[model samples]
Target: MTIRRLPQQVADAIAAGEVVERPASALKELIENALDAGSGRLGIEVRGAGRTLIRVVDDGAGIPAEELELAFQRHATSKVRSLADLEAISSLGFRGEALASLAAVADVECRSRGRRIRLLAGEVVESAAAVPVPGTVLEVRDLFANTPARLRFLKSDATELAACLKVVQAYSLLYPEVRFEYTNEGRVGLRTLGRGDATAAAAAVLGTAVAAELLPVEGEGIRGLTSQPRLHRGSRDSLLLAVNRRPIASRALGYAVEECYLGQLERGRYPIAVLELTVPPGELDVNVHPAKREVRFRDERVVFGRLQRAIRAALNGSQPYRMAEALSSAGSAWRTPQVHSAPAFAGLESVVAEAFPAAPGAEGPLRPLGQVQDAYLVAESGEGIVLVDQHAAHERVLYNRFLAQLRAGAGASQALLLPETVELEPAQTAAASDHRDWLAALGFELEEFGPQTVKLRAAPLATPAARAREALSELLQTLAHSLPQAALANAAASLACHSAVRFGDRLEPVEQRRLLEELEQAEESITCPHGRPTRLLLDWSQLKRHFRRNY
Candidate 1:
């Protein structure tokens, strides 16, 4: 066989494969085009999970009647003309291949003011005059229809719809001044205000409940929203990040956000945020990927440090953190796990009831005075004072018990009146399936209810009914992102954190004493499962030194 040049249609379809990986990919391109045209209002409608149809109507500058046909040609663009223009590319869709690629594999109908251009297999087959508008109404139908192989790669309606909604939500944060509406199968999923209030838009996109808990963060060139420790998720699914009002994926930015929440939130849980960084166009490169989702920065370390410091300030100012609460005696940082030789009660063959052995005194080491902020238990000791983290103390106690029960192959399983159901993501669902027996061994009686949902009939740990759903979900998410050996510790830590006493809860004197007793009994009473100090000790000598007292 002799080598020959491929047809233009074949090349266009191949390019389409790069930009139109899925429905969300095409939707993102259309959105960028709409934004570049200065659309104040963007309306989107999807059918059959965006495989059958995706229509976008924008109120921006429309194409001229004569240029409608030329718009679909390969490499045709008005955004950039020379190589120098690529350095300072400001527009989102400057590559100009998105439209051509989308048109190559799908039936495209473009409607402008008094003109309609239709394409079939990347060719302009029909051009006619239509009713006029100031913007563009682009309709893409039968996506991957010409390429049946690509059509087969589509996922379930729910999953694909989630993906498309994620794109819309991200862009909504990028341009709060643009009124955005998304309708799936004629049902409106999201609608945002266009008054340039990012807060209101945030509340509309991420439910008013979560939006209310977001902390405002601002730095030299970065400004956006971040969630308080209480308003976090099992995964970074809702972390919306953008640069210059264009949503992009940057691992550095994601890590910077998480680093701010380091000791505040438990392991495996991520904070909710929409961080928008404003950088000079020349300092950033957006041409890394065909979809333009990834970007490169010139001074990443400096920018990352700025983002880290800004978010850390916001988190620190929001409330008193666990580390700060215990820092009086536990040193400047959280407890380090290496301080313990091994798990105090490693194999759990035989249990030690007195985990925190009593000293030679009737009142013992801790004498309860009262609660501080309704969170920590203030106690009097031979030392100046002891501030006991009620949540951390309870967490330490429960973790040892849960792990011991796991070693015993079965702990006391507490059944719920109504079987609680939790819906997992696709990846989590797969992880749960792979480790079903391991979870069962850890005292969880879970069964697959549906493709992506699980039913929890019984739990080993004494978790509340209201928290059972979230507790199990976070545990699975922890296991989903860990290795086999380390995953067990992550799971145990998650269970303890979720089942332990929460901050801001009122505790009676008797309950407080019981918690102290149980916590003392744990082998590793110094630190919680995740290496947070359970109590801080301030001796009399240290207290006296502050007052300049010499004895």
Candidate 2:
């Protein structure tokens, strides 16, 4: 086969695909252009998750009448005119491909100054006069309309809308000086004051209650907000990182931040952080990707070390964490598993047989000897020695109970003596509003107290009152991204995880015994809801082999 040049239309479509993978990507490009144009205030509106329309109005320098048509031409740019200009680019959009690429696949209308131009599939369809305005108003309608296959790949309205909101949230945090008003389907979802206050911006995006718990992080050239050790999320989605006010994805840098919280957070938990680093433009390359959401640094090690030290210093200066109190408070609602046993172990053999049906003639039930390190239960079983992760076992037990309650629609709720108010992040608020009925079925009695704020009058029976906020936050994080098919299971798991007994919680002898009895009867006791092993077995033969005493 011989290689031939591709058609211009095909090439344009391919280029547009690279730049505008989704509605969110298109919005990102437009917002960056607006920011680079020195827009102090931005108004963003979207309909049908940006599939029907995306309107952006900014108060910035308007385009000249003659340049209006040129703006839609490929490779046309005002930010870069020379090799030197391209080498150390600081502007968010300098490639000059945003407008052209967007126009290739969608109908675009641009109005700025005293000029107006409209394009259909990258071809001029209309060019007429419009009302003079100081800034620009760009309306993108029928996105991916020309590319039928691309339009079919878009996600559901809720997921796509969440992605759009996420893009806005990132910019809001990065540019606190620029006020942002985001409207979705004619409803204002988020608004931030542009007074240049980072905390206030964070509150608008991450919710006031969450922002209040963040500790200030200040270093030589790094600054932002970070959560306390006790305040963590189920995923790293909330770990917002930017370089020189440009939001980019860097897993290495994210890991460097997480490294500072080693041992402080649980294995699967990560801190909620908004860290911005000021780096010299000459030392970074932002042209790696078509969307420019990724960048390469000249000295990754230096950045990593500085980031770790700065965040670590901030965490060190915060108030001391009370481990015992926290553990106790988290387990305040935990009750000993109600398992009936015959007097003097009369029917223990049947329980053992049920637990290990494969091991015939197995010794009776396990005898809870004691706890090791206050985290694991050491029990003597017929197989030999068994070490149980106390927390994981309890989590397994509660997961089964919560899942059953969710399925049966009979979840027992524990009412709080006094209603407590909680605020969630904007994205979380959207998720909560959509899944309010499901949350209620999971035993969360919530009332809308304010925007992104809810009053918790009751919680799941297993969830302690002190941990109501944490439980809701974890569930919301899971629900925000989980698919419809898996939402209920994930919510049940989140509820179980928050309500279960925590590691390091000292258990009394009776409690430990009751826990073992419950585990013996659990539907699935080998692993917890998150797939972590709940118990480990050490057979007598292996122990004898290790000791070299095979008799």
Best by lDDT: 2
lDDT of 2: 0.81
lDDT at 324 for candidate 1? 17
- Compare the candidates by TM-score and give the number of the best one: 1
Backbone N/Cα/C clashes per model: 2, 0
In order, the Cα lDDT scores of the candidates are 0.77, 0.81
TM for every model, in the order presented, reads 0.63, 0.61
Candidates' RMSD to native:
17.7, 23.6
Instruction: For candidate 2, write residues 304-331 as lDDT tens digits.
Output: 8889989989987765231101111121
Summarize candidate 1's per-residue lDDT along 366-442 as a digit string, tens digits.
77888889899888776446668899888888888877766666676677789978889987897788877667776
- CA deviation > 4 Å runs, candidate 2: 1-4, 320-551
Residue pair clashes in candidate 1 = 355-521, 356-520
